[model samples]
Target: MPSFSGNEVTNEQIDELRDAFERYDLDSNGTLSAHEVRLALISVGYEITEAELYDLIHSVALYDLIHSVAVRDEDRLDLKKFIRMMAPRMVHVDSDQSLLRTFNMIDRDRDGYVTVQDVRAIMVVLGEVVTDDDIKDICQAVDMDGDGRISLRDFIGFMHSPI
Candidate 1:
């Protein structure tokens, strides 16, 4: 894990931010449109009004337009610019640690493994309405070995993969 001062940012941080942005920008349009934002929020079980969606899109677009330099003819928001724009607004200073803690919390047995039930339990704790089918799908996705359990390595690898 990397550490940062209260005001300083790094290239790695920029890359992480950009990767996250691109992950949500599924259309690869270099901009998060209203439709994309709405779909993403709804997929994550968040309900947003049209007005709220517009406000969110406008805020993100303004940040990108003002901070992100035009790399090509498309004026796409690059990694560095996005990080610079978002760093000051970051609410969680210890997100990396929090992620590790979350993983540990989900590994309830402390046996260095997580199962589909573990995932379902964690989702329930997070207030996510996960179904048995959803848990099975998640297990299929993460359990690369066709085993019943997901090792810590597999779990982390799955988390790092693109959604």
Candidate 2:
């Protein structure tokens, strides 16, 4: 998504922002906490601290434009406002080359495809426990061709998906 300095915003940008906000609304609440916002940021590869995150929420002009009128409480922020604050900086690193690198890194077998088992094993190594059903759901999501595995094409599609 491109950054806009003018008052005008495209419908596409608004949609993207809305989608992002909803995804980060973990409990389906209409508001976002600093912690939820932080997790969303980390998911997109940002290494932010609580202080810095607050600096963004408190100081950025974008925050002003995005803050909801219903924001009576300072502790939590409205999801729609959060969306506006994030949409401009919502850069998805899902380019072909980037996805290729990610796929290659995760595909340990070098068999030209990635299986749920591969990811499960990697997660284990990282001290994360992933259930079989979770892995299966993950594969189902990226296995666009129903091969029970993830291909580069499928990965690109996953990266391009709204969620």
Candidate 3:
């Protein structure tokens, strides 16, 4: 599945999302309704329903992202924002600054630590399945100190560790 997170999105990914948006925006308008999103994903060959969209994206994260740019009209949303929010995380950069930037992005609330909710939000947003088991797996993989959270050091190690 194609995924993106924060500014880690590559130019190719942006172009692809733009193309998908254009294809879905049949009326040539910048906004999209629930029906429009359904049709757009279908056009791109995804076998999904409107309800499934909600399930695929975490409820809190998806609502927060959508409500930020929510339209006054019912079921209307900024398609671009939805696509961007759904993009997966990619931390391929190797510089210390890059690692810090990735940490900040993942930290979301600037809490200096990565929580399970934070990780699940990004994963599910980017079209990845984030089951309860997957959350535990991620914790084991990145929560080096075993404190049930990913500290700055742990996050940096995660970014630097081999994918």
lDDT of each: 0.58, 0.64, 0.60
By lDDT, the best candidate is: 2
lDDT of candidate 2 vs native? 0.64
Per-residue CA lDDT of model 3 for 1-163, tens digit only, reads 3444435655654554565566556577786656566554543335465688655444434556566844344355466555654454222422455457656766889989989889887666555565889888977789877888999899666544533
Rank by TM-score (best first): 2, 1, 3
Off by over 4 Å in 2: 1-10, 34-76, 90-130, 159-163
Model 1 C-alpha lDDT versus the unseen true structure: 0.58
- Lowest lDDT sum, 10 consecutive residues, model 3, at 85-94
Give me the candidate number with maximum TM-score: 2
lDDT of 3 at 85: 41
- Quote the lDDT for 162 in model 3: 38
Every model: Cα RMSD to truth: 7.6, 5.3, 13.9
What ordering of candidates by lDDT runs from best to worst? 2, 3, 1
As for lDDT, the candidate ahead, 2 or 3, is: 2
